[model samples]
Target: MKDRPAFGDPSRLTTGAKLFLILSAALLPLALIAIFATLQTSRVADEEARARLRVAADESARSIAIELIGDMVALRVALNALGADAADAPSCARVQGVFAQQAVDGTRFAVLDRSGRVLCGANFALPVALPSDQPIAAAVVPGKGLILAISGKRNGPTARAFFPQPFLATLGTPTSRSSGFSSAIVVRDQELVLDTIDNAGPLDRMETTSADIGIGDLALRASVRSAPVTSSLIVAMLLPLLMWAAAAGIGWFVVDRLLIRPLRQLRASVAAYTPGELIDPGQVRALPAQEIRELGDTFRAISRTVALHEAGLAEGLVRQTKLTREVHHRVKNNLQVISSLINFHARAAPSADAIAAYASIQRRVDALAVVHRNHFAEMEENRGLNLRAVIGELSSNIRATAPEGASSVSIALDVDPFLVTQDVAVAVAFLVTESMELAMSCDPSAQIRVAIKPSEIEKRAVLRVVSRAFVESEELRMLISSRYGRVMEGLSRQLRSPLHHDPLVGAYEIAVAVLGRD
Candidate 1:
């Protein structure tokens, strides 16, 4: 006896399994692409996040340093008013008033002798020792404040300023502290941290960065915890794919209801159907969708008018054409809807960066649409796409659809006439679009030159994009290097070749396969 088929056999799949499998197969390529793109760009994203944190720390330190300088300048001016002669010192009441006006909140002023004794203006006890022969010294005493001592005339008199914990905590800008940044002021000579300002909540990992305060032996150090890389990568990779899955689920539901279910029912009826017997009108009326119902009625009519054997062949061909047309129409409609929604949101976006991001997404959608349209049109002929025409049209569309600032860019293409498969066309279009955008972003009026020449290898071509803006401005190059590096790498991978860069000449080159002439 013959062995029975296993559970995994295609013939054994139920309707739902078959439908689900078809959807999964359709989405497999897209899911793989999303994963690859995320993997390629993950390092860049992490680096950018850390770079932002460092910049925030540096800025916070600088702002506090400025405030410290203001306070020190006020102390010097007040001491000058007191006069260098110790015998003719101002009255304690007058001295207290001067100190009170000059001192900020959470701070105290005191006068001490060379023996570390309080002379005058000692309303509060000193937390740190008096200065030695050195002009100035700073020390941090726990639970009190930072003490800055200014020596006067060989231990005769010393002026000391006490910056308490509460006062020092409020030195930096409020923005950084609110966004999970904590900072502390340190006296380097004594290796002591005077005060810490920690307004941040729980964090994953605290990374500390330091900046000089520009005062004697003082430094400002800021710390912040970065978001978890694993969680970020997972979300980045899955979010769009989840959205795609939802859309696919809806499409599957529609197909099953309108087409698949009815076809399955019709198929059963046909299996039970006799050669001379007419199709059952009750089952025909029970079918969903007017198209399927009409299809059933046509099948019944054909069976009545023509020979049964020829009718069966004709019905199968017509059914296939109808199903293909219907599915294609739905897909095209869905894509158009997606494009319209992107346009609506892009226009309503609040910032230039958001609008530019939306534009970038829209361009990718357009690129896919272009490739699909060309592939569908050429399906009957089996001839490969015209690379020159596709690139020319794509270049014009990209230039016309560029974000507001890049409209004036000049993209000159020197593509030779060549035939290329759909895959090669897609990679080329994206590579060219990415290169031009890099040039345009650096300088709106930047001239971009694209040249595609036949390679020494038959059925292959080398593409080169040249722009002065890439090499002329260091700031622009640095800004786009990490951002575009992964994107260019992914495109080159699709072309099955490495992307070569000529920084001196501001040019990029890659080799890609083309269709050979018959």
Candidate 2:
């Protein structure tokens, strides 16, 4: 399976995501604080605006009350003056003149008797009931567009004044537009005598601040539309948002430049690296963040050390292979020398038994030489020798070096090509040589056949040498057993399996199992 690329792997998050998460973690508290500050500032601003509106309304109410009181005092003086004169045309004319001089332009004065009847005065058509104990009392008549104020000394003739809608409305006008508020004069909490705006809508139901006018049970109420949103208030509300945005932008820039970019570059460089290649120390040092720069430097050092170790390992492997090949070459040459010496001794022997023993020794030496030659030949490939090739060459050498009278003996091979380690090849060669020697001792003219195959049960390489020869005499059997029995046993042990001999199938069969190696 192909390996996944690190950069786009779904399981691993990017540096950008990590930096964004960090920025979010840092800014979350700041955002919450900003929101809280904004709400609190708005609340304070609203309260201040409401307080200012209430103060303005209170001042206007007091001024209006003072004006009403002065008008009442002047009406009382005119009523006292009119009390001495008769309720006649000349007296009423004189009293009207006195009231006009003491009241505002839109105010009308009148005189009323104890029966609540208008006796004589200007605008005296309506009868007004005056409270005996109270010095002043006011009534709002919306249908007539007038506010009636009744005032007199207790138990004395009462005086009445009619305030026009224009006069009452003027009292609330000064601060209404400038302060963004609606003003109203209410009498006894029931009648709206004058208002700067209509007070019949939902705005009337909103909470308002009131001040007692201190004249005739009248009150002044001011209802604000809303707290004005001044430039300072807007700034207070938006500054935190602006600051939060700026902080986020700045944080992203700083993290990207100092941390995210450097880490991304380091990851890319590490991913692109291969064994034995050195990373540039200058590249690692160029990182902006100090900690990441140090980490990059450490990684560079580790990669450099790994490259050096790998180079040393490669050089050691080459030297070891060369030394192994040289050793195998020398061993093959020494074995050849031993085989030549044995051949020389066999040729010089006087008796047939001595010559046969020497020849047998020469064959064994030749088998060992063949193993070294095969091993030396395969040293460059760094693999085991081919067992089939080694056994073929060994069988050929044995047939060629056979004794003169044993020329008729034939060796046939049914060997399959299999690769085995050096030690296994040597053991198999020796086992084959011992089997051939035993067959030759039994009968010099026997037909020797060597077959190699994999075992069915253990899956090991099995070398079977079968010789169609007979040991007709008990003396030859004893000689063969005594001479090669121990040698075969040792070769079997080297192969890690016992040597099996079966003579009931009309052939001397010796089988050795060879184990495989890495």
Candidate 3:
């Protein structure tokens, strides 16, 4: 997908999916590596198995060969006796029987004469019986010690042949069986070599082998299943899987916790900041580590830059307000001299327009005086002005700004008991009182409502003034609108504040957001 908005997309991952992704990305490759390494280890185990089998087969082959060759050599002594050949026939038979008894296990000593005839002792059963014309029997040869190759295949039909002294335990004894191989021996060259067979196979399966020591049991040989050719492959596969599962689990838990988890937390923290809700150690509680502390310090620096700009604006307002206060004071003094001059000239003017103009000059001067009077009068020890006191004085001063004997210009103060800066209090009271005075001049019967209330919705103080005075007249409306913006802005600067205007309710609101106050 090229892109899809996060809010509505079905494919977008939930928290669980995201965490699984984190785990897989960190763990899966490690699992692969572990599996490969384990397989390598398993190959070593397999090699050892083959080596153990080789050693066992070699030991059994050599042991069987020695037993058979020693038995065949004894047969030579019995044949060499001259008296043993004549009237020693019964003694010869007894001697042969005694020697046959000495045949250890599968080693059945048969004394075959020069004609391959079973003369005095037992014949070992060949797996396949040989014809009378055959030179070598299943495990016997014509000459000296030689091997009767036992095929890896199961032996064919077998028959039991008894010795003069039979092996009592027969085929079931420990000496009868060998590890991973089978054994049998038979007499060969009348009195010469015997032969032993480890494994005999069809011509193709019998790996052609040469004998080193020319004993009666000529050669030792055993066939081992080739590596990777048996069912051991399944073990090879399972060994790696088991080792990988165990190792990958250990790696994921240890490495992810030690390395990946902290890095992810840091990534989330970095992404969470908005324009206003940036890093606040007061909020996140210092991240709790030396490394995160350094990161947080960098975040704090960015936060402080915005704080500093806000502080600079506040400081600028303080300076602008101080300068404005000086200008207001000088204006007040200049207006006072003008008011005195107006009073002097009112009697001198003959026309009614001239007298009304002089009275208007005096009223404007009194309005300016109301601002000065509010700022200078009874400032609090905190160097801040009280909104209540300023409102009270402005109401009282309105009586002064009124036409002669018009005490009917009643004022209603709905202000909450909220405090403000001295310069802000003075400026707001001046503008509001002047607007009320002008409304009064336009309509003598006008009922003015000046209200100061804490706005629940806006979470600030609001100033609302409404007058029906000359509301239809373009001149009075324009004057009201123009001064409304200027008054609120000037008051905000004077108080080092931000103002919100609500034209719908005819309200001007100021947020007394003084830092360090809270």
Candidate 4:
């Protein structure tokens, strides 16, 4: 026999469950790959944003450095021109015109003597001390701005330029607002020239780009805040999730329609089928899958084959029942004919003994005829004769056929209802006839009684015959011991029990136990 699925075994999974599992197994790796790709893409995007910010900061620093170097060079040339002319008024006005022409907004230039005294400039102050060897230097004055001091020569003269802090704010790239990076420019060893700290709000970390302005003393540091996560990054991260959900939905639809639904329909069809009923091939062919359709076809073929065999078996059973009934009918008719012939022979017998013998043979033949008649009657219904009915008929017949002188030998029957096979009923009928004949032969006026009842403990049926006028006659004993001994033995063998006899106080009793149908 084929092995059955255990409880909770995966092999017993329904079509839809199996389909869902298969789709899930197939999509799992693809989903993982999509998620991984989205994450990597987001990372790359953040890195690009940071790289752009760095590039912008670096470019701004280079531009600022070039501008600062140009300013310092112009300052040195102006200082040299002023030194060549004199510290007179006309030469001073000419130097002022040069400074005015070269200066941009938030820029201030001043000429200072070797004593560090400001002379021909705006927004400059005399310093308490000056560096002897430093060619350029910067300072952050409180509440003022950034100040750059450029020496004309070693301690000869110096030019000072003051740039307000707001000028440094313009150095950031235009994309800073969208990129979430704040820009700042700071002078080395001094205070911040420009700071976006207030505008930037909070800073996680700082990224800086620095450049030396080539004026030997000034360096510009361009700084910006790190890039924050943007909406594009969020969209990138969520894209894979959306794709996976959509793919799962689509997979469910496709697999359920093309595979699961059809298989479910096929399962329902097969479950609904009953034995001996026709299976429709059209319904089976409606499945979309080729292999499943073929399977349906195979099932249809098998069902058809089974139906054909059932039809043949039913026809054969009908013919056999009819043939059996006809055979029993013929046997009963032939036995009756033989009984009639014996009765006729008895009527024409030469002597009293011959007539008695013929009568006895006629009665026995009539008992057999009765058995066959009951068998024929039950054959059409596929059952046995009712035991009560058979016993009643047999007793009546035997008493009617008794000799003229034994007409007073009345038989009483108290038999229970029993259903037995044809062979058992026939054997029982013969046994009853023999017992009745013996009782009548013993005494013409004998009171004979036959009874059959079920034995509860032994699980069998018991038939008993009792006669009150038993004489213990020698002829009766000889008949039992010699002529009828084999007949009684055969009936005993049929009943699967011994024939028992008892002679007791004015009564002779005989009983046999037979296996019951129930």
Candidate 5:
């Protein structure tokens, strides 16, 4: 067992989703509140402004009607007193002064001399053109203080007003300009008394149509023309925003504190990982949220499992080292015994052919032994087999044992400087020797061609031993495809592969896969 390492606490975990929800919860209500507040405030302001305008309209209508009636009555009296006599001079003066007073009060008054001709102060009147109308020379007078107006109270491009009432009325009956008494609304110009509080923004925009006032016509019998201030609209729009914001805020709190923060901590641990280094989730806090707390526990469990796995892996590696050294020692001893046996046989042999065959056997055995020797020489940490040196030794030995004068039968190796497993290298060496001996026997003049291509794809070195001289031999083909092939096939099957052989135009090839390119 390896010594355990300490790990940090797992409290800080923030996921994007949780953070988003938090922010949304915090701001959603605020935004909604702002929107609703703004909308309702605007509505209240509009209603208030309209209401003010309506009040102004009502005041102006009353004042205008009073002035009109007073002016008209005085004018009629003045006309009646003009009997070409000086008897009514003071009366005429008083009446004229009253007319002047009415004029000074901003009432646009005119006395028509039966032909609708102006006969009073500010005498320029052909009464200003009415909206959709001509001044009613045709209209009959109703009773005294009877004010008439358009049925609708719409404001057009001109002043909107009209009144038809008894102008004389014996000159003594006091008349009022109140709705249903003396005054009414008209749409001809919309406002009978256009009282702007010292001229403001365009009066036209402020002007409301009869439809805007919830009225069918331009008539305003008793009410003001403009809208009234409404506090109700403000309250209506605010309620929804409050509910939404509260919900949003709660949601945010749940997501961030409960979910996001803990996940972020886990992510940090994952991000800071290195290969083979087990993370110990030591003393991790119970996350604020259930899911995050569970996740932390899960991560801790994984870490514990990882630590155990790492310890087992380390022990296995140590055992592998010891096993490798022992294997090398045994292989080297066996190879030495074989080499000694071959040397003894060669020295005592009566025939050169027997000596060569024994030498061939000895050389292959030595090749296997040399590979094992390399393994035994190294420590437990040293792993893998060197194929180049092994192959070269095999080739060199074969050169030494072949018939002394057979210079034409040359041997060459095309092997990469790679490492392979010991079993694979030993198999490869014997296969090469067998293949070369078979080729030499066929031609006695053939040059052996061998290639050791390390495959990056299969993660193995493939040894393809080819001989151009003995490429088309039926016996060699049978041995390769049947007998020797079976031995190689078993090795290949152990490595989870299949041995492959090919007869080219000028070469008989044996291909075997060995582990490792380098």
Candidate 6:
């Protein structure tokens, strides 16, 4: 059995041979398309040539007709002169003398009676019969000339102009004759050629087109002829297609060397780029085009600069994060120290009112310290303070330091995973502490609920504080009717939103902006 060719295997063919086959396949269809387009163009050019030939033929026929019509003008003038003088005497002799004087070349003019018998003319022998009831008529006489007859009125004498061969031949202009178009006077039924401009080519080998033009009773046939389509004409048309294919191949080869190959190498280099590593320009430095080599060099310089700048920025960020953590740690320690100093002073105070004041001051300070600790904890990711962690820690610290009567107050937290700025967290902590303390003061067994829910607005959350003591206790209302109301209002203004109070639901809601999810 014969072995089949391994067409699918790349290893069987050399790279150069594969490329040659690919290029041939690509260019073959382009050559075919070019040939078909050229042939269509040739067909359109042929149709346009034929249309031009028809126009030339028509113009030639019109030129002959115009000349014939001009001659009639002179004939009418002579006939009118003959009629105006006929009443004085037998003016036939004088009319004939004037006709001979005015005549040009072999042109003849005559006056005919009602029976078509010549009354006065240079040539009186040729007597013709006038058609009945016809006012004007024309006819071409073979070997003689074209005859035109006109009359003034019915049964009146007729005026005739005889245009001979020499005069009629000269009517076909030299401009028309030289353009390969030929004009002839034809009698359609008789199939006769009375007069014609010389045809340039033989009748059989040429393509011919004809148009018939009528001048009175005479008909002119205008004809144009050209050589038929042949092998030489086709060869002449195909030369351009061959040249176009050669040009396209040359252009593709030039672009592949100058642009396409270099771009592919550059793309590979870019695809292999690493974040902190500089790209080497050596890969593209030997490219054929100066502009491409320069572009690669510029990219190398820019990448190196970017890599260096990024490294510097990373080092600076590490140092900045350490410094920020230390600052928050010191602030938190300072707040705790202040809280301890207040606690020590509260134990030594003689008045109960003064001790209560010291405890209130200590709670506010602890809330601030809790916010700073949480903010520092979130520094590694830089996602702002977690509201859930802050609220949970604050609720624990508040219950731990609850006043003597309010030691049994239960606090519940329903906080979402919302992250907020340090400033917003501070205000939120103060608002929660103030609400919890007011609820405890009204009823020591008060049940306090704090919820943080996502708001309809993007990157925003609603903080709702609820307590049954807020709804039923007149003492809680009186507490809010004093400085506590103003304090809540100031916290709301600090958070940049209004605090909404719903007495029926015993809940206070305020919207706060938050950082987006990790």
Give lDDT tens digits, candidate 3, residues 1-518.
68665885546865444555565666667666766775676677557655654554445445544544444444444444411352336645654665554455434444444444555455654433343332222333333222232111122211123322123113212342333332223234222222233454443122112222244233433333323323465555556555655555666665556445645666676677654445656533434556656766777778677677777887998898777767767776886788788889987999867876777667666656665655554322345555666667666656664665345776567766555664555566665765666666666656667666665544356566666663556655676577544664665687566655444443444544211211
Leading candidate by TM-score: 2
Q: In candidate 6, what are the lDDT values of residues 355-404, reduced to their tens digit?
A: 88898888999999999889878888877888889999999999988988
Top candidate on lDDT is: 6
> Which regions of candidate 1 are displaced past 4 Å?
1-333
Q: Rate the local accuracy (lDDT) of all candidates.
A: 0.72, 0.72, 0.51, 0.70, 0.54, 0.74
Q: State residue 146's C-alpha deviation in candidate 2, in Å.
A: 6.0
Quote the lDDT for 233 in model 2. Answer: 69
lDDT ranking from best candidate downward: 6, 1, 2, 4, 5, 3
Per-residue accuracy of model 4 over 131-232 as CA lDDT, tens digit each: 545667766664446667776655576687776655545543444444344544444455454545445555354555565545545555555554445677
Indicate whether candidate 3 or candidate 6 has the larger TM-score: 6
Query: What is the C-alpha RMSD, rounded to one decimal, of candidate 4?
Result: 8.0
| Reference-based lDDT, residue 21, model 6 | 60
Model 2 per-residue lDDT tens digits across residues 1-518: 98766985545766666666667668767877977887787677668767777777777787777777776665666677556643556656665675574356566877876666666765455544444455566666653434555544455566778776667667655453443466667765355545544444553323368888877677888766555456776677778667766777787788889988899899998998898987778889899999998899888988999899999999999999888888888888888888888888878889998987788778888998998898888887756788878988998898887877777779888887777878888888888887787777678888988888776756476677776554345744685578777887887888777776665553433344444433
Which 10 consecutive residues of model 3 have the lowest summed lDDT? Answer: 150-159
lDDT of 1 at 454: 90
Q: Which model, 1 or 2, shows the larger TM-score?
A: 2
- Compared with the true structure, model 1 gives a TM-score of 0.37
- Model 5: which ten-residue window has the lowest total lDDT? 151-160
Query: How many clashes (backbone N, Cα, C below 3 Å) per candidate?
Result: 0, 0, 7, 0, 22, 0
Ten residues in sequence with the least summed lDDT for candidate 1: 189-198
Better of 4 and 5 by lDDT: 4
